[model samples]
Target: MATIFTRIINREIPGHIIAEDDRFIAILDINPLVMGHTLVIPKEEVDYIFDLDEKTLGDLMLFAQKVGLAVEQAVPCLRIGISVIGLEVPHTHVHLIPMNSMGDINFSRPKMNPSGDELSAMAEKIRSFL
Candidate 1:
């Protein structure tokens, strides 16, 4: 079975995509920790981040670096916080969250339920900077 991220990358499921290259895609998290929270994932459905080849792993972070810079420009926050607790989804992903404080990246906290419209707007905002 294809993972949800693959479904999104293939357009089998909807995703508010911020940026993507041939190897990876960055999209807004539907249930976000913060307004500009995004997930960066490889096109291949690898179950673990470390399991990726060194080149893919390095490329993933480089891709993420570009997205993180754009997210910082597009969103209002002290800085972008990165986390890789890959438990929520089977696909390996890096979370880029807008953070004004330490608690902003806390995964245990309740997630925000932003409307689809809100997510779409935010995605476009991030893309503008890309």
Candidate 2:
């Protein structure tokens, strides 16, 4: 079965897309920690980010950086925090979170349950800055 990220990449599941390339896709997190929070995933379904080849891992960071910059510009935050906590889902993924402080990126904190309209609006704002 395709992983959830793969389904989003393949359009089998709807995602608030922020950016995409031949190898990667960036989309808004529905249960976001903050506005402009997004996930960057390789099109390939690798289970662990560290398991990716050096070149591919390097490419993913560069790709995520570009998306992160746009998120920073579009959202109110001190910085964009990059995190790789792959326990929730099997797929390798990077979380590009908009953070005002270190605590903003804490996974233990309750996630924001934004409506679909809010997600769409946030996605557009991030895309506009990209």
lDDT of each: 0.96, 0.92
For model 1, the superposed segments whose C-alpha errors exceed 4 Å read: none
Clashes of each: 0, 0
List the pairs of residues colliding in candidate 1. none
Residue 22 lDDT in model 1?
Answer: 95
- For TM-score, the strongest prediction is 1
Which residue pairs does candidate 2 place in steric collision?
none
Worst 10 residues of 2 by lDDT: 28-37
With candidate 2 superimposed using the best TM-score fit, by how many Å does residue 32's alpha carbon deviate from the native?
Answer: 0.8
lDDT of 2 by residue, 10-128 (tens): 88989999999999999998898887889999999999999999999999999999999999999988889999999998998899998888888999999999999999998998889
